[model samples]
Target: MPRYEYRCRSCGDTFELSRPMSESAAPAECPAGHADTVKLLSTVAVGGSSSAPAPSSGGGCCGGGCCG
Candidate 1:
């Protein structure tokens, strides 16, 4: 299940709901029983250690003066 954020225009309230992706676009009622609501764009945060090796400081042939 994915969580979605919504804002109620009637009461100016913000809420979140967890539902299937199939119903993500379905209308949601606010906790205050307001049907006039709109779904808000969600932001995702990703964090992790990269597996790729870092670039070498000793730049390649150019830095080694081999290109000249």
Candidate 2:
């Protein structure tokens, strides 16, 4: 389940709800029972290491000083 943030325009309240991604666009009722609400843009944080290899310090013409 993904969490979605919403803001209630009627009561000026912000809240979050956990639901399926398929119904993410569905309207949500605020905790104050306000029907006039709009979904907010949420930022997602992805955690993991990058697959790209690190730069080598002892390779290439630059490292070997062959260009000069």
Candidate 3:
């Protein structure tokens, strides 16, 4: 299942929902009892990061530089 974040355009109410990947968009009213719920896609955390972190400077390869 995928989690979706929503924002209410009428009342500025923000909420989240968990559903399938193929599921549809927003439905009825928002949590603030408003009918202006807009689906925000930019901030959606769909998946995890793929890239790894850079190497550290502190290491023993530089002739005991790390302990210095």
Candidate 4:
């Protein structure tokens, strides 16, 4: 089973569920009993080294931000 995050449009509530991969795309019922829920895009981080370099400051035009 994998953990999936869902957001309910009716009550504006967020929750998590553990279900089979085959049902990953299936609709989830909110804990508040709302059926109008959709799965949320989740962020996953994978790392094995504590000495990993920190993320850059994301400065300049290289990033989406302008270099103003």
Top-scoring candidate (lDDT)? 1
The alpha-carbon deviation from the true structure for residue 37 of candidate 1, after best TM-score superposition, in angstroms, is 0.4
lDDT of 3 by residue, 4-43 (tens): 7778888787888787766646374677688878777743
Per-residue lDDT tens digits for candidate 4, residues 1-68, read: 79999999999999999999899999899998999999987765344447756656885356736655
Off by over 4 Å in 1: 45-68
Write candidate 1's Cα lDDT for 1-68 as tens digits: 89999999999999999999999999999999989999988655233457777756768668756788
- Residue 51 in model 1: lDDT: 71
Q: Write the number of the candidate with greater TM-score, choosing between 2 and 3.
A: 2
The RMSD of every model to the true structure, in order and in angstroms, is: 8.2, 7.0, 4.6, 10.5
Judge candidate 2 against the unseen true structure and give its global Cα lDDT, from 0 to 1. 0.87
Model 2: per-residue Cα lDDT over 1-68, one tens digit each: 89999999998999999999999999999998989999988654443557777767768668867779
Lowest-lDDT window of 10 residues in candidate 2?
42-51
Candidate 4: C-alpha RMSD after superposition: 10.5
TM-score of each: 0.65, 0.64, 0.54, 0.63
lDDT value, residue 15 of candidate 1:
99
Q: How close is candidate 2 to the true structure, as a TM-score?
A: 0.64
Q: Of the candidates numbered 1 and 2, which has the greater TM-score value?
A: 1
Model 4 ranges off by over 4 Å? 45-68
The TM-score leader among the candidates is 1
CA shift of 66, model 4, Å: 33
Ordered list by lDDT, greatest first: 1, 2, 4, 3
Q: Which ten residues in a row have the lowest lDDT in candidate 3?
A: 42-51
